[model samples]
Target: MTASWKNINKPSSPTTAVTAAQVANGPVIPPQQRLLTYSPDEWEGFVEEWAYYCLPAKYKYVQRFSGAGDMGIDIAGFADDKRLKGVWDNYQCKHYDHALRPGDVWVEFGKVIWYSYSGEYAAPRHYYFVAPRGAGTSLSRLLANAAKLREELIANWDKHVKDEITGTQAVPLDATLRAYVDAFDFSIFDAKTALQLVDDHRATPVHTARFGGGLPARPASEKPPQEVAATESRYVTQLLGAYGEHTGSIVTHPSALSVPKLKDHFRRQREAFYEAESLRVFARDSVPPGTFESLLDDIHGGVIDTHDANHADGYEKVCAVTKAARDMQITANALITCTNPKDRDGICHQLANEDRLRWTRS
Candidate 1:
């Protein structure tokens, strides 16, 4: 039977007049501006990312609650293990088409008051209404004046908040519930601007992955310490083996590199190895997990064949494989653009450190 699926030639379609709508090119939206366009779920994800960067310093634990039954909490950062029972802060994420106003949040305030009064959780130490477009002028004014905000909440309770908190039942502002509202602290309510959220999110590791911006400037790699630390034991031993095999002598340690050329080569290799290690550290703090590992895997894949090829000695094998790695075209990994020539060579040593690559057959 003919393999029609594998046919080489296909007829091209006749061309027709195309308008701008057909091509549909629009101006690129920067990530900061793009935050306002995220879907409800995506906005919550952004809030989660922001909380990770901004809350860890002050909160012992941070948790997110979603769906219609989350009471008033969207994201909560607990100051202690007691969680809701203990001191905590609330982040009410509002993903609205326009800036949040007082009307948008009266129900939220009522829910917090009702739920906390009923002992579902203690009233949050601080309640922040985080929205992409931020709070409108009237809401900002209300937030600034705590007594007025409380008064507005009470005034709007019957119209906006009486029946809105839960799906099952309408929470009436009875005498007891009214008393709770009267005594509740309204000054805790506030808003976080989009600029503040984005600025804080910039410090997180996933920022570059979420946004297409290039990485922040890398710090200089620390020089390798004078004595070989235990972390370098495996790779350093492998290097000595390669040197011993090349010179046909028992090269026990790095200090045994008596020849000037070999000494310089060893120094450069150590420096490169340090550079690669520094790159690894930088990846841990700058990108998502496994990014540096993927770069290492790419280097290994590019140079493994050269490493297995026959050479005069182990040192020659190291040189060949490292050179291959340096010239490799690694485009897929996120860390590729952030790496240097020395990092490529150092990756080979890192692979050796893991016994993924070896300089000598033995």
Candidate 2:
């Protein structure tokens, strides 16, 4: 099951423009109600957004064509280059006010045939009709039988398809075109119900962003582990050398590690070292994973700013510097104990911002 808080912390719905009826009525309609009255163009965009996130990530190039000139396909998906040569599938979005009947599919079927016959694009691997309301029972039974769908299309051709499919020209299905249409793979065509679209949409990442569904951005309580290894040899050497300078170690050889005074200092330093190390882990974990690399890049790009008005005053440059230092210490102290990185910056800034950076000691 999805880890969404459905009741109290339910994800918010996408915002839509208020309808005129809603404005005059003094009570707003639900978003779901707004969807029922979407304009033709709006339904196209809805299907496009749905196809974009729901399609396999490898498609990478999903696009919607502008109206009228798009030769039949409304939404196109390509695996590589952004053209018909690489086009893999197409979604035809229809937002009828009622359930889809077999008669409604006539013009849609004609456009696909005429376009394919004229070599505008090859027959798509999958051709889906995505509508708000799903197929009617009559159409559903007809869709189950490919041969029956063909017969129904040919039966309704002149009345539903002929003049509507071609704007200025009358293009009747000749004997050759009729044979081609019958032989064409009807199984490739499918109807996506509104319920199906809703089901898939509810599981998408966008759904979480649209509605506060995912786990709260709270940081983990347990500190990240600090395991000192050869990778930290430079620090270990500097630390042990600094200890030797303070305590005056005379011991040489590898036995330096066993020197009593040096060992005691090292013992005391362990807690502090790991405590600082935990903060580093906390900062790294604060943002979405892998953003620390971006933070480093931003720093390399010279995006760091030091003049925090709250922390520094310009009475003297020296005074500002000392104030900043004190601010750093306070921020570091709070950051070190932060169990949740999602909490505010004194806790730890998740990302590097030009106005303010959350980390103090780093």
For this target, which candidate reaches the highest TM-score against the unseen true structure?
Answer: 1
Q: Write the per-residue lDDT of candidate 2 for residues 225-304, one digit (tens) a residue.
A: 34445533444444444444444563222246665755654444444334434445654433234433443333223323
lDDT of 1: 0.89
Pick out the ten consecutive residues of candidate 1 with the lowest summed lDDT.
Answer: 19-28
- Pairs in steric clash, model 2: 11-211, 11-212, 12-211
Most accurate candidate by lDDT = 1
Model 1 per-residue lDDT tens digits across residues 162-238: 98999889988899999999999999999999889888888878888887567899999989888988887888888
Error of 1 at 34 (Å): 0.3
- The lDDT of each candidate is 0.89, 0.58
| Separate clash counts for every candidate | 0, 3
